[model samples]
Target: MSDSRQFQVALSLLPYVGAKTAKTLVSYCGSAEEVFSAPSSRLLKAPNVGQRIIKSIKENKSQALEEANKQLSIAEREDVKILIYTDKGYPKRLLRHEDSPYILYYKGNADLNAQKTVGIVGTRKATEYGKAMTQKIVRDLTRYNPLIISGLAYGIDIFSHKASLECGLDTVGVMANGLDKIYPPAHKNTAFDMIDQGGLLTEGCFGTMPDPSRFPQRNRVIAGLSDVLIVVEAAKKGGALITANIANYYNCEVFAVPGNLEAMASEGCNKLIRNHQAHIYTSVEDIEYILKWDLDERTTKPIKKSVGQLTMEEQIIMNKLEEDGGTMAIDSLSIKTQIPLGQLASQLLMMEMKGIVKALPGKQFKVVH
Candidate 1:
């Protein structure tokens, strides 16, 4: 790591500093480097900066920087990416939440910012029914080609990851522990496969153990990373419920697969639906409807077609798409082209048949590139 960047890592090591406070310090000092360089009086001027925090900063300076340097070296040697919040590779979704991790240790080939992401979480003691549903859901969702996300725990979490792998989809396992070791130990092989097929992500750095208190915090990371979270199965209270509650707070769609009333595993899911915290997940179609994943949605190289080859409406749609930078939501296209919804749907369908356009998630369309 660069000398200047190590200071950013050092900020996380300060005794009282957390993500929000570190950001505040940076905003006050103008940069991470300045935060360290500014004297105590100057640091005091920053909002929430007081005698205690300034003292912590002053006392911990050398040790924090040294530890940060060691962290950087270990990350480099292990092929792990240490992404501070400001880095381009950091998960943008997490940025919207105040409690998002300030840094992440990622080691994988999968795109952290995949076009679509789905988080599946549930009871650690999964039932056979839960396993079946997870497998089926992943298989059906394969058409949309979304990245599957789970906690890498047993039962539904592991089922979700395994299903994703079997379907040839990338799956990221958010860890409660550090990248240095897999918690639960049994999930190690699957975690290893995910490193090649998907990824393992955590805010915990090297040598950090998976303490019990960190699991709830880890669930927040899973919720933050997902576009939507599915609770395949959960008892009345568990980490899955915690994740669901967090996802709801983020206003991301949450789906709860319905299970029989007699089943203990269904209680939490049923409660979420009953309380309107989540939609009742009946099938993949439920997901398709809310997310607007059109069956024909895709991106492809645009074929050269003459204006003469298109009907007037097709030409109009093409012109609108071009004006909109080659992509537009269905509603946007309708208003832009001044076409009625039914007519526009028909026109887009015809266009898809001719390879002039493709469907995308959320009813968006893009001209074949």
Candidate 2:
């Protein structure tokens, strides 16, 4: 229902209120409804509460709620999901950043919190080299089944999205404008396809235009969503570089494709590497190394272990691994075995000592024959 949702959306609509201020209000007032219901005297008691913000809230409260109601109606009509910052369905990775948007309009099937996520960003003026690399990277990363994140702009962004679709990988497009209107209007078909496979996400509300300023803001979302960001190509001053910089600030691993020297598109990437802001990306192995992903199963010969001798819990772990190609991460094993991480880890260690299973990189395990 749009009951609490209207107020949550309205919190973002209030004048002079941004992500931090909105979060502060919610923290102090318990909820958006309480923030509205609280008197000016109580509002004054909230941290950083100023006369201007209070007046804006008091005067425009009804109008913001009305606007929120309209937004909810439009979202309902379009099948768009409005994620409040506090919602469990909101992207957990994005929530870690202090400047992350308090509201997200998402329309897609992709899990924003997929086990692996790779952000691909580059110049709008992508060359054949850049375009080729974008697809190459997406295709190469298929083994990990990572969710691809991009800005949905021309050149590299669109290339990544299309590549992801072709590879059957989920890819989310972070747009600078509202979901109600796809900017550039050229990639409409691809955007529509993404809605089924991956999805589109934006912090902008309905009717929000894609201004020059909003692109940098959008870049931050792409960076925040990604576990690791790959810059296929970038110019000296572009959204791609901005995204890479933001990723570095957020402590997210970043990789830059090595491009030819004396090329404008390569300048940003080369500079990023030279400045130690990003790692040099050559192959999918580079990603696997940084992320500690155990994509390839161990090829070593399995040790003989009798299945009948295994404890009930060890048998459960064995069954799950065998069900999932004889390999799984510790987190995944715990999930499938209905065991807590601490207990699962202890059991896996004992199994390893008993030669019933072998450990692999990235905290993964494989059952021995």
Q: Per-residue error at 114 for model 1, in Å?
A: 0.3
Cα misplacement distance, residue 107 of candidate 2 (Å): 0.8
lDDT of 2: 0.88
Error of 1 at 266 (Å): 0.9
Q: What are the per-residue Cα lDDT tens digits for candidate 1 across 288-365?
A: 777666543645455666678989889899999999789877877898899999999998988887878877643567
Number of clashing residue pairs in every model?
A: 2, 0
Output the lDDT of residue 282, model 1. Answer: 88
What clash count does candidate 2 reach?
Answer: 0
Worst 10 residues of 1 by lDDT: 293-302
lDDT of each: 0.88, 0.88
Clashing pairs in 1: 297-359, 302-369
RMSD of candidates 1 onward, in order:
6.6, 8.2
